[model samples]
Every structure is written in structure tokens, then in C-alpha cells.
Target: MRSLVLVGHGSHLNGDSAGAVYYYAELVRQQGIFAEVIEGYWKEEPSLRQVLKTSASTEVTVIPMFISEGYFTETVIPRELGLGHQGPVPEGGIARVIGGRTVRYTLPYGVHPKMQDVILARAREVLPDLDRPEVGRDTTLVVLGHGTTRNENSNKVIERNAAALRERGIFAEVHALYLDEDPKVGTWPERVGAKNVVIVPFFASEGWHTQETIPAELGLTGTATLFTDTPSGPQTVYYTKPVGTHPMIAEVILQLAAEASQARGGDLDRTHAESWRLLTRLAHGGLRVGEVLISPYSGLLELRHMLDEGRPTTDLLTYVTPEGLRDRVRQDDAGEYRPVRTFRTLPRGWRAVVDEADLRRALHYIYPAVVEETRAYTCHSLRATPWPTTARRQTGIYAKVQKASSAQVEAVAQKVCAACLRTRLWAAEPLGQTFFDGVPGGIPCAEACTYLVAAVRDELSAEKSPEKQDQAKLEQA
Candidate 1:
């Protein structure tokens, strides 16, 4: 027997979050496609873990009822179900093993092509006269979704759907706006210029956003139609129900499950699995420089995996930033600092040394007479040695140095060594011996010594100059 599980992000405050999940699950049940159809929620009754165990069928297909392939669909759902190492799951994909059961996981409901039909249907219900030539020209279709700054990918589905809707020419124009991102709901009146506008919430359910936040933003008094004066003229705004609440959405879910079951026989793509494995490996041991951890965020792991497969990665460095590493550090519960195994060699002017002293100087130089110790540091070395004593005493720096140019790093190294020599902290003769002997193995020490010797040669040249001899004679006179 085969089982179907419809997973939804249920809300504790309202039952509406999981309302559509139950609606579609029942529809699938009545169709007799599987022996069992169960609805599960992250926050409501019949949790995913409980329902998976309760189902008697060895085969199951799990469909995520989300509008976008964002954090929840990619990371949270898979982790909770113990599927694919609890990471991002490919859209409309299969996970061959989950507690020894064959499982097919479909993409979120929002990105499916049929979702445009649901959107159009929602608009039609509000204004049955949309097909009328006069109404169609004056009317505009607006798709409202939750846009997040944290993950730009969340907006892709919404934007793509809006484009598709415009091509169909059901309305005069189509617009998409987000609650969390730019072109906010507050500016909808000014941005969407039409006498008759149909606004449809792209959310999965009619929760706080659709029922309260959206209505208040649009200044509606709980009525379906509201008249407001816009730049164009007097506009009639018709607010429709959420797309997920539409009963026709069940057909889309069924289609997704059927496709997943037939296309790959409930087996995850081998390439995707390999990519996940590489991500895990990099997370455990990869060269972390500056704000780049090369773990999962910033698409570094994906870039590496693609390169390994001989695929081109044009935008590998797009997501690499200092903030990405800070976020990862905050998430580390065990306080275990993973060693970096591979340093990403960037183009010219992107290389810098990661050292405790250099970072302290850089920070202090950037700030106004402030000297604060950092907890972690990252550096490149020719050979591995025991962790630095200073690092062990302090919190430790877990980042490699990044600069605008390699020349800048070399200049800093020379300046640092010269300062140490003048302060009597570094012995010139011993440092010179160490440099020539090459016993103390590490790129940092070798490179510093090279510049130190150059400084010495320049000093010797100045002492033997004729100008210096004349100055000595004048002082004697």
C-alpha cells in the first residue's frame, strides 16, 4: 500500500494555516490514488514524525504546501522528516530512504505552473465580469507574497508567476508586491495604477498576513471592494482569498505526487545526493577566509560541487561575505571550530593574510583609537602546527585575512616586521637565520622575513651614502 503525507506549517494561533493541507489531503483520499492520505503539521495536530510512524504503507509521497522553495521547504521540512540528511530537498524530488520507507517529496505548491490557473480563478470569483472588454482593460491583477531580505530566492516564484499572468492578458497589467520587502503594501495604491484592481494573496493560508496585515495595509474595512483615489483616478480594489484556500489547488498537488512517483520511482537524483554530501564535507572541513565559510550559505558549497562535476560556476563569489561567517558562528552550539582544508584562490587583489596582530592593527586603524581583542582568527599556513598560544588564551580568530590586493598584504607584512625590529621585540640576526634556514615552516614567517631582509638592505644603503657622510662631518664641526 502507498501513503500520501501533506505537510504544512501549521499555526498555533489559528487553524487556517493547516486548513488547506487537510482540504487537499481529503481530496487525494477520495480519489483513491493511495491506500492512505495523511496531513501533518509542524505546529498542529498529527505531527510529521507521528504521522510517518502511524502510516502502514512502506511507500509514501510527501508534498510541501508552500508557495516558494525558501528556508522552510528547503531546510526545515527535510530535517524534521529525517530525509536527505535534513538539508535542502530538490523540488518535486524523491528521497529513496527515510526510516526504511520509499518516499517521494514534491516541490512546494507555489512554483508549479498550474498555480497561475489558481490565481486567475481567485480573481474571477471576485469579478465574474473580468472577461468583459471594458472591465479587463481597466482591471489589474496584483499578486501579494511574503518577500524576505534574508533569502532573495523566496521572491523568484512570485515574480515568475506575475510575469506568466501578464502574458495571458487577463488583466490590463500585473504587479507583484511583498510585505517584508520593497514596493511595500503601503505603496500599492501609487504603484498599481488601475481603476479596477484584483489583489490576490499568494500565501498558503488566510492567517495574520491575509486576514489582518494585508487588509490594514490596503486600508480595507473588512469589505471585498474598497474605493480609493489613485494617480490615475478613482480605483476599485477587489481583494480575493488566498491562493492556497482554492479547492482546485488539490489537483496540482495530486499532479506533483504522480509525477514524482512515475518519473524517478521515488529515488533522489544521484547528482543532488552527491552535492549534499560535498556540502556536509565542506561544512566539516573547508578553508574559511574572512566572512566566507565555504559551508552552505552564499552558494559556495553548490559552486564547489558543480565544479567537481565539471560544470561552470560563474557566480561562485556572489554570496561570499563576512556576515555569512558571523551568522554561522552564531549558530554553532558545540563551539567547535572546524579547520579549513581548501582556500579558495580568488583573483588578484583579493588575497590577504589572516594573523592576530595584523587583524588587531587593521581594526584599530579602522576605528578611532580603540583596541578590542577578537575571539577568533583565520590564517593560511604552509604547514600545520599546534594552535597558537595567544589564540588558546583568547577566544581565537577563525578567519583568514582578505584584502583588496595581494600587494597590500605584502606591504602590511613589511611594515609589521619593520615595526617589530625597531621596538626590539624581534632580533634581526636570529630572524635572518630563521629565514635563510627555512626551518620554521609557514608562508607567513617566510614572507615576513623576505621583506625584513629588504628593509635591512635599504638601511645599509642609506648609511653608506655621501649625504650621510657630509652630515657626519657637519655634526663634528
Candidate 2:
């Protein structure tokens, strides 16, 4: 027999959290898709671990009813169910043999393309009188999610869904607001700028956040239509039940289960593949630079020169091992020099030696605007300090850059570039730059100059591109 387990992040404070989980479990059970359809939770009864232990089926599928891939779905759920390491269940699928039973894990349902249909259906329920064509012109749809400071990954799917809805022009405007993050629920009146506002909670169930906190924050007496005054004018705000409570969600769960069962063993391995792929044509052919490879065993960073195919040279071929950088050197075939394969341990640093050409290529590849703007800037000005380190330290820099006015972005860019110069990260020669004389005391670990260029470029890219913003939201979520 096969079993299906619907796992939810149950609430300890209220019974609402697990309501939809149990509802869907029973709904699927009635379809007779599996011998048993059970519901499990992190905080409530029939805990994940307990349910898995007592299941009678030899095979089981655990589908997380989450809006995005985050801590709970990636860690707690997998650990409790004994599904591989306590981290992201592979993207393709996850099947593990544990305690004589096979468990297949599927990705969160929120990312599925069909989910937009469900969201649209939920919003339409609140605006029954509004025609399909008039929906976009008259109503503003707001997707309210329980954003978290702990894991930005929690809100990716919600933001993606919101972006998709906006692109479709199905509403006057589509805005994604968070309970714990930015675009606060209280400011919806002015932020939405629409007389008719429809809010749909992007939660798996009607928990405390959806049922109590959201209502209080929005100044709602109940789920019924309420009139509120905003900076613009008076507006009508309509709230609906959580998206997960919709009956159509049962079909989504079954679809996810079917997908996992089909991809069971073969593609699951491919799902755990690396996120970044460095193609040979791009690295060696187009870029004409060294190839960056990862060590299979230790996952260490290795830089191999394209010119020296067989022979390793100290020129640029180096690997960052656990201890330090291993600079590979090629010796003569004769007895005069050391053996052909020899490596010397270099001091631990970001790069063995910064390559100007490589840095330019990387910057242009990652952020073309950065390269175009800084064309006159010499490599010396750009090479002094670590750009990657500085960029990482400045969290949310992309949003800061994006939100800034046209004048503000330029002014801020000048200030940032000047600061980099003062810190010795940027050069002062070409522009008669007399910003700062010496480097700052607490300079971070120096990485390849190209990496720093790439980092800054990425921020600029994010600022200029809306699609990049959506992608960033997905990543951050």
C-alpha cells in the first residue's frame, strides 16, 4: 500500500494552522489515491515523526503545504521524517530507504505554475460583481504573506506569484506585502492606491498571522468589506480566507504527489545538482580566462589556466584547499628541476594573484553597466581593495540602489565609489582622484578582484532590471 502525508507548520496558539492540512488529508483520502492519507505537524498532534513511524504503507509521499522553500520545509520536516540530511530536499525529488519503508519528498506546492489559477480563484471570490475584464481596472490584489527575518527564502513563491499576477494585468495592481517584512499591512491603504482592495493571505492555513494579527494590523472588524481612510482617499478593503483552505488545493497536492512518484529514483539525483554551472565554451572560449572548478571530495576552489592544458603553472593555476592555497608548478622533464607535478603552499588569501583581464571579463559578464560606467577607471584603482567583501557587508544594497531616485543612485554611487577609493579598493589615478590616501585598517579577506567587480555589477544589474528583482525576491524568499 502507498501513503500520503500532508505536513504543515501547525500553530501552538490556535487550531487554525492545521485546519487546512487535515481538510486536504481527508479530501485526498476520499479519492482513494492511497491506502492512507494522514496529516502531520511541527507543533500539533500526530507529529511528523510519530505519523511516519506508525504508517502501514511500505511507500509514502510527504508533501509540504508551504508557500515557499524555507527553514521548516528544508530542515525540520525532512529531519522528522528521516529523509536524508536535514536540509533542502533535492529540487527534483527525494526518495530514501529508511526503516524498511521508502519515502518520497516533493517540492513545496507554492512554486507550481497552476497555483496562480488558485490565487486568481480566491481573489475573484471577494469581487464577485467585478467582471473578468474589469478586475484589473477596478481592483488591486494584495498578496499577504508571513515574511520572516530568519529566512528570506520563505517569501519567494509569494513574490513570484504576485509578479505573475501583475504581469498578466488581471488587477489594477498587484502588491506583495509581508507581515514581518517590508510594505507593512497597515500601509496598504496608501500603498495600494486603489479604492477596491482585495487581500488574500498566502498561507497554508488560517493561522494566528492570517486570522488575528493580519486583521488587527489592517484595522478590519471582520472578513467583511470595511471602509478605511488612506492618504489618497476612502477605500474599501476586502479580506478572504487563507489560500490553502481552497478545495482546489487538494488537486494540487495530488498533482505534486504524482510528480514525486514519477520522478522517484532517477531524476532525484539530478535534482541535487550544483546551482552554478561553468560551461567550457564560456570560460575558456569566450572569456579566454582560467577555468574555475570545484574539488569533488573537499569542494575546494581550483583555478586552472586554459593555456597550460597538461602542465600546471604557478602563473594562475591554484587551488584553495582546507589549509591554504596550493600553487601548482610545472617542472622540467630532466633531472635539473623538481618533479613535473609539484605544488607549494601559499598563504591563505582570496586569490593567488588578481588578473586584470579576468576581472574586466567577469564584471562585463555579470554587470555590463558597471564596466561601462567605470571604463576610464584603471585596474590599479579597482584592484586595491576587495569589492566582493564590501558588497557582502552591505546587505540589501540592491534594493537600496533600486529604490533610490535617479539622482540619488548617482550620488550614492559616487559616494560608494569614493568610499571604495578611500578604502584602497578603487584607484584614484585616471580621474585625478584624491579621495583617500591609505587603506582602512579592517580590510576583509581579499578575493579575486573579478569577484568584487561581479558583486558590484550584480547590484547594479538588480537595480536596472525588474525581472532581476523578481528573481532576487525569489532567492531572498
Candidate 3:
């Protein structure tokens, strides 16, 4: 079957790091163009290396939902897929035989010319006729990036997009600015030669750069500052959210994946089969993944959400479609955003069931690839990352968690992970904690999660603070 794995640079500290990817991936999944649509992240769960381990597609395309072509698009993503560029490169990207399967890797999603459409859409949200030369003559459009020397063409995308936008004559001036290098975004006041400025951040998601750093650099109070005081008299500043958030980008992904698929040489026979057909085999019998219970009785396959296996489905909210099920699981009973879907607080008394053909779509809406991965783990074909290695790979604010003593990790997991349903398989490995190899009939967590690591970092920082230590002593006394 055909499947697509969209990789993005997720954040350990911000749950919204991959929001755009997840949101659009779900949209694409609903379209059913690809048998399976899954997400892999460089900084989150279901890592890039193992994303395809449980997938059923023999012919798959790996597309990075990144806005630039550099270290990530050129090297990191391919290496994670074990491509190593050993074979001849194809039109879309490098076509490599990975895990004995021919997998096509597409270049980063940002290089296409169609991306200009999404940026223009974002601009229209503030100024309806921004595309018209009459209305855009006095406006300056800034295409921003974290420009670098990592690759010779590192700044090509932003520069190229900027040049293309300028050619459209939609704005008086278009400047490609970077945060990490010269002609930086912070120096826009002096670099951009226009009174009316509009900055469109070339990022895949809203996180540190889009939400914090960019706003700080531009001195924007909100999305639009009308006639604000600036170096060149009072000029209006309009800041559009990252283009990835625009609805049109999801359509962009569809075109890119379709293009890559056409370039791959594969046995088309049975390639169009639903990727979730694997779930149909177990439809006759019940299978459990963590707290989700899948049962077949009375000629109906029922997938229920509950805290305990002993609980009944009485008074539970029932949903029959994947979309409805996802909406329910994205939040806890308290109506707070439940970023980690496997948390023990998984709103109890909820049920979802679709035909056997759509079982994977429903299950993946909540648990992702957990069911298939669990089966692989049971068959001894899957291995969990050791706790130390899992901790060491954390980046950004969570990287400090690597310094956490084993005892500290144990204590933090006991508190933070105590409310999650995911079996901490890492806990059973070397240098691990007390013991939780996970019981049968539960989803296995191959590595530590952001939720647990954040808690560990907090506790470690608290212990390091003399004031917090004094307060702890006071409480104990």
C-alpha cells in the first residue's frame, strides 16, 4: 500500500511545534489520497528512524514539512531514513532502497513555487488587495528565515521567494532576511527600504521563532500596528502568522506527495490497499492498546476509551467517525488541551467504532502507530531505546534533563508518568528505574516523552536552587 510520512522539526518544550504538520496531515488523511498518512518528528515521539517500522506500505514517500533546504533536508532526514544517498538520485528526491523497500524521499516542502500562494493568502488576511500593485506599491514584504551557511543554497529559498514576490509587484520592496546571519530580520528597519512593512515568517510552525523571537525583533504589539512610530516616521507594521498555518498549505502537500509518488518505480499491484487493512485481521477478536479497548461483539466492533479495563461502556459518549473521535480525544474531561493523548486522564466513557476497513484511521487518530508497533514489539522485531540514550537525545530546554541523576529520573517518572497510559518500555532497559516493562495488551513507549522530561528538568532545576532546597527542607520539617 502507498503511505506518506511527513517529517517536521517538533519541539520538546512547545506542544504546538508540530501543530501545522499534525493539522494538515490529518486533513490529508481524511482525503484518503494516500492509504496512510503519518507524522515523524526530529524532536518528538515516534522518531524519524522508526516511523516506517509499523507502516504497512511497501512504497512510501518521506516528505519533510520544513521551509528550508539545508542540513535537515540535505543530510539529517535522509540519514534518519537510512538513505545515506547510496543510490542514484531521482527527479523528486533520492530514491533509495531502505529496509529492503524502495522508498522515495522528496526534497524539503518549501522549495516549490506554489508556496508563494500561501504567503500571499496570509498577506490578504490583513490587506484584501495586497496582491494588487496599486495597493502594494508602498508596502514592504519581508520573507524571514534562520539563514545559515550549513548548505551553499541555505538562503536560496527565502531569497528566491523574496525575488519572486518582488517580481509579482505585489509589494514595493521584498527583502529576504535571516535571524542567524547578516541582513538579519532584527535589522529590518534599516535593511527594508519601505514605510509600510509586512513580515511573513518562513517557518513550518509557530514556536520560539514565530511567537517569541520574531515579534521581539519586529517590536510588534499584535498582528497589526497601525501607523506606529518608526525610524522613518509613523509607519504601519503588519505581521502575518507563519504560512504553514494557512489552509492552502495542506493542498500544497497533496501536490508534492503526488509528484513524488509518480516518480517512484514500484509494483502497483495491491499498492492501493488501505494501509489499515492490518487492523482488520484482529477485528474478530478484541485487542487493547493502553487504555483504548477494541472489542468485537454483537456484530459491532467497539473501540472504547476508559481508565480501567474493568469499566463498562455504560453512559459513554459514542462516536462513529475518525474526525469525531479525534476531537474528543484532543481534550481532557476538564476541557483542557491534552497534548499527550495517552495520558491516564483520557476522557473516560467515550466510544468510537467504524467498519473494519477504517479501523486504522480511527485508532491512529488517537494512538498513532501504537497498535502496529506493539504487535511488532511482541514479535521481537522492535527494540526500545535505553533510558540513558533517550534522555541524551533531548534538545533545547529539555536537554538539561540528561544531567538528571538516575534517581532523579525515577522520582520524576513516578510523578509525571504516573498519569499516562503508555508503558514506559525504557524503564526496563539498562540504567532505568524501578521496573515497568509494560504489561501485555498495552502500548509500548520506546523512549521517554516530552511530558516526563519537562518534569525531570523542573525538578532538577528546583533541586539546584538553594531557595527551593530551603523550602523543601522547611516543608519536610
Please give the lDDT score for candidate 2. Answer: 0.56
**Candidate 1 per-residue lDDT over residues 272-373, each given as its tens digit:** 234334324544454232222223334323212212222234423232332232223222224432111111111211212223212222211111011110
Return the number of clashes found in candidate 3: 0
Model 3 alpha-carbon drift over 4 Å, by segment: 11-15, 43-45, 70-92, 130-133, 146-156, 168-170, 178-196, 206-238, 262-282, 285-287, 297-300, 306-314, 336-341, 388-463, 467-477
Q: Which regions in candidate 2 have their CA more than 4 angstroms from the true location?
A: 10-17, 224-228, 263-477
List TM-scores for all candidates, in order.
0.53, 0.52, 0.76
- lDDT tens readout by residue for model 3, 412-463: 8888777776667778542222111334325667767656767788998888
lDDT of each: 0.56, 0.56, 0.72
Global Cα lDDT for candidate 3: 0.72
- Candidate 1 lDDT at 477 equals 100
Off by over 4 Å in 1: 11-16, 85-88, 222-228, 263-477
Best by TM-score: 3
The sequence of per-residue lDDT tens digits that candidate 2 reaches over residues 194-286 is 778889998877667877888887778765665744775777888988887788898888888888876333221111111012222233323
Between candidates 2 and 3, name the one with more favorable TM-score. Answer: 3
